[model samples]
Target: ALSVLMPKVKVKKNAKSGKKGKDKKPQPKVNTLISKPKAAASLRRKLSGPEDVPVPDDDSGDLDEPAAAKPAKTKLKAAEPPTRLTRGQRKRQQRKENFLRKFELANLIGKQEEAFRTGSLANLADLTAHLEEDKAPATAKGPKRLGRKAQAAQDEREMAQFQGVLGFKAFQADPFGALEQHLKNSIRLQKEKEKTAAGKQKAKLSQLKEAFRSKKRLGTVKNKFAKSRKPKK
Candidate 1:
């Protein structure tokens, strides 16, 4: 006879395990020593001290006395050497100086000629003063001296005038031409003066002739009247 097999029973597990309940974050192990407030207060009292240290007030007499005025430091400027000029700059400067010198010389010459024409010694005095200035000594505190070429040029200029004649380079270059020009100018001026005088004389003569003619006409009219009054003789 076959025995009937009994069906296996399935038991349901407990949803909450005793181990899980026991494992629960083991109550964060408290540090009893550190957690004692009384102990911490006693330790703090032992470590700390009184903070009231006294500082002495400054008693030096300097604090009471007026500060001596510090002597003002005068900044002495170092004398800088003159800047060296470039070749082109030097050339340009030389040219400018030459032009200025020539212009001044021309002006002086004109003044001298004018003085001569007007018979005045004032320009001569000025020229002498200028010459004196040129001859003045050149010291560090005084005016600078002329260069060799410039001094030579000055000497030549001094020598150029002799007996009321100017032996200038322009005249020396073409004396005949200069003379011819001078002659021409004089002749022109003379002609102009003669022309003016002739015109003035002609005008005077015309005025006199007009006056004489008018007087003669008046006399003739008077004579005619006189004859008419005298009537048939």
Candidate 2:
């Protein structure tokens, strides 16, 4: 009765105003937690649109071009067969190699000695120049075949020169023999000195032993009393 007495109010219902249409399909939910890089790349691809790669036609002029237009490969040369050497040739080569090896050793030894004497590093160029000057003869003569004696004399002269450079006394023709003789003489002298020293030592030992024996034979107390009592006048 109190609601009837109040003013009547109309309430409008909330309804769809647009015309009815077919129901739209719901889209699958995309993961929002995708990596930033992947999302960025996908966004870029979408913006760029589909890539269109050109397909080559088989009948094109490029296919008809000459094969020579491409780079050609270089062929390697075949190895040559080794030449056979005669016994004499082989022997000569061996001798030459041996000479070179000996020359190198001599040079190294000379350098070392020079360094030791000078207390400084020896210059290779200067040493080589000195060696060359020493080797050079006064006259430029043709190669001559030398006899055994002549060769030996030449060797002795060269050795003497080398010794002189090293501040050693010039050695005889047979340096080895002279050195051996010097060693032998020194040994002999040393032995003689030893023998003389031994003889002197033996004499001294014998005299001491004899004196000791005599003293022991003559009683110590009797000898002392005899010495103390003077000879009767």
Candidate 3:
């Protein structure tokens, strides 16, 4: 039954995800471009001073108010009221909690995946459980971050070992030596391409020079000695 349902369920899922969803991978959310919100925040910071961290001006959710500054009394409106849920009030709270927790976890997973996809410095260590020894001393704080060497070695071994698993093996099966080799090949290929381009440019320059000389020679040749026009000074 599970075997029979698997393909059908997969088909339904795929059908739900139309053409655009099939091959489309979620974009990474880390590195070069952080989340859009982060990028927008950075822009806002640049435009406005650092203090432009738009403090939640209206803790009060007053949608009807005008855009301009409001009086303190205006900030407090009777129409706006806070909402509270009772312990047992929500129907199917257990199911809702289960679904909510699952959804939250999925969202978190997608976020992390996006970060990884974006080629951010994957904090693989966070994936593994850590102890107090792993963290820095909280008391002595300055520009608190992992030092150069620690950050360098942080997930190096872990990543390699993880890659050593079946997935890594599949990757290794690819002609590309460890992923680093593929990267190195890319850099080498780019440099070689530049070199080839440079060579072509030189060849083109040489051809142009040769063509110029040929044109000059052809132009200067005796035109049956009829029109011996003097060359322009």
Candidate 4:
């Protein structure tokens, strides 16, 4: 009877507030290294959400089937025709081969010499023969014609050599010798012309004097005057 009387006095009901319908913001998930048991529990939680979705099996029937064999690889290449050497290239190759052959011969000669020095009696005669052959005077020949380019190079070299025929020392000592010679010739010619003109003038003056004497328009005057003195005008 006493409890009923106390509750009957008042029972205030607080409002539910706005928490019921408001949506909560989802937080970003962070994954830490978890033990197997923790991982299994987490997997269980995830499986609970997607219970209808099918999970992939680790060993499917496809793994039991044999895989398709890979096709054998083939290298495809274009057939290349043999290259023909040019005339110049062929000549150069031949010359190189000849040079190599000569080098071998020289090596053989050198070995023979070495053997002779070691008192090999068998090699001594051969070495002496070779030395004698070498000592024999060889006939020298004029320069060989290699090719057109070589001829051009030779011409250029000859021109250069001819250009320097007047020794550089003399040219450096008197660089203006040619010019000086030219100037001297000019001066000599001018002097000759002047002497000729002087001789001509002297001859003309002598002729005039003879003409005056012959005409008697000269000398003995001074008394009456020369030719009447032009009428005092």
> Best-fitting candidate, measured by TM-score?
1
TM-score per candidate: 0.27, 0.23, 0.23, 0.24
Q: Which residue segments of model 3 deviate by more than 4 Å?
A: 1-177, 227-233
- What is the number of backbone collisions in each predicted candidate, taken in the order shown? 0, 0, 2, 0
Clashes by residue pair, model 2: none
lDDT of the structure predicted as candidate 1: 0.76
- The candidate 3 region of ten consecutive residues with least summed lDDT is 4-13
lDDT of 2 by residue, 97-153 (tens): 999999999999997888878977546688889999999987878799999999999
Clashing pairs in 3: 28-118, 29-114
Model 4, residue 82: displacement in angstroms? 0.5
Off by over 4 Å in 1: 1-169, 231-233
Residues 1-233, candidate 4: write the lDDT tens digits.
22322222222343466344334433433333233567656666675585565656865646567988999999999999999999999999999999999999999999878876887677557779999999999989987758999889989999897688466665657869855875898999999999999999999999999998966744556534756775765
Between candidates 3 and 4, name the one with more favorable lDDT.
4
Tens digits of per-residue lDDT for model 3, 2-117: 23212322222346645445464555334332346677566656666767335467667566766887656645556757667676766567878899999999999999889988
How does candidate 3 fare on TM-score?
0.23
**For candidate 2, what is the TM-score?**
0.23
For model 1, residues 1-233, the per-residue Cα lDDT tens digits are 01111223334444666233433333334444347878756655556655565655776644567988999999999999999999999999999999999999999999778878999766567788999999998766856799999999988877764523455665778888877987999999999999999999999999999999999999999999998899576
Model 4 stretches astray by more than 4 angstroms: 1-72, 121-233
TM-score of 4: 0.24
